[model samples]
Target: MTRNRVLRQSKLLCAKGVFECEDLTTLNHGVFMSVKRKMSDEIKSVWSRNGANSYKEARDVVHRVEWEDYQHWLDLQWPKK
Candidate 1:
């Protein structure tokens, strides 16, 4: 599927509180779940900065964020060398 489609699907999955999916797995982790959990603090900060009114809205904002922007955080969290 296309990148936007995958993002949309991931947002939907997060709304339903279902994080894991076979096709969406990366490094054996659910994309949304990994982002949400690993970067909870940062996500919360972004959510507040964006004035997201609800958890779902925050999640949508998170889904739309650029993954590359968090590369440093990801590297620190996973440290895959």
Candidate 2:
């Protein structure tokens, strides 16, 4: 099968949370699982409202939350690395 076909098949298999096919070995399966877990967490955090009154209000809060000093925090965490 082609690369696209393999990727499509792998996506379908991942939907079922199982890798019974030989083409998708344990290593590939684990990588997909790890990616899925991370993506799920990111999606949950992005869509979470944290008790906001409405979707628009939640979006406004997220946009207004400042990260202006994020570089300072990063520099503190990793000095000259």
Best candidate, TM-score: 1
Please list the C-alpha lDDT of all candidates, in the order they appear: 0.44, 0.35
Question: Which consecutive 10 residues in model 2 have the weakest lDDT in total?
Answer: 47-56
Estimate, for each residue in 1-81, the C-alpha lDDT of model 1 and write its tens digit.
Answer: 575575557658788887633443353233345455665654652221122111233345534444454454345574234
lDDT at position 47, candidate 1: 23
Model 2 regions more than 4 Å off:
1-22, 43-81
Q: Locate the minimum summed-lDDT window of 10 residues in model 1.
A: 46-55
TM-score of each: 0.29, 0.25
Candidate 2 contains a number of clashing pairs equal to 0
Q: How far is candidate 1 from the true structure (C-alpha RMSD, Å)?
A: 9.6
Model 1, which residues run further than 4 Å from truth? 1-22, 25-31, 41-63, 78-81
Q: What TM-score does prediction 1 earn?
A: 0.29
* Backbone clash count, each prediction separately: 0, 0
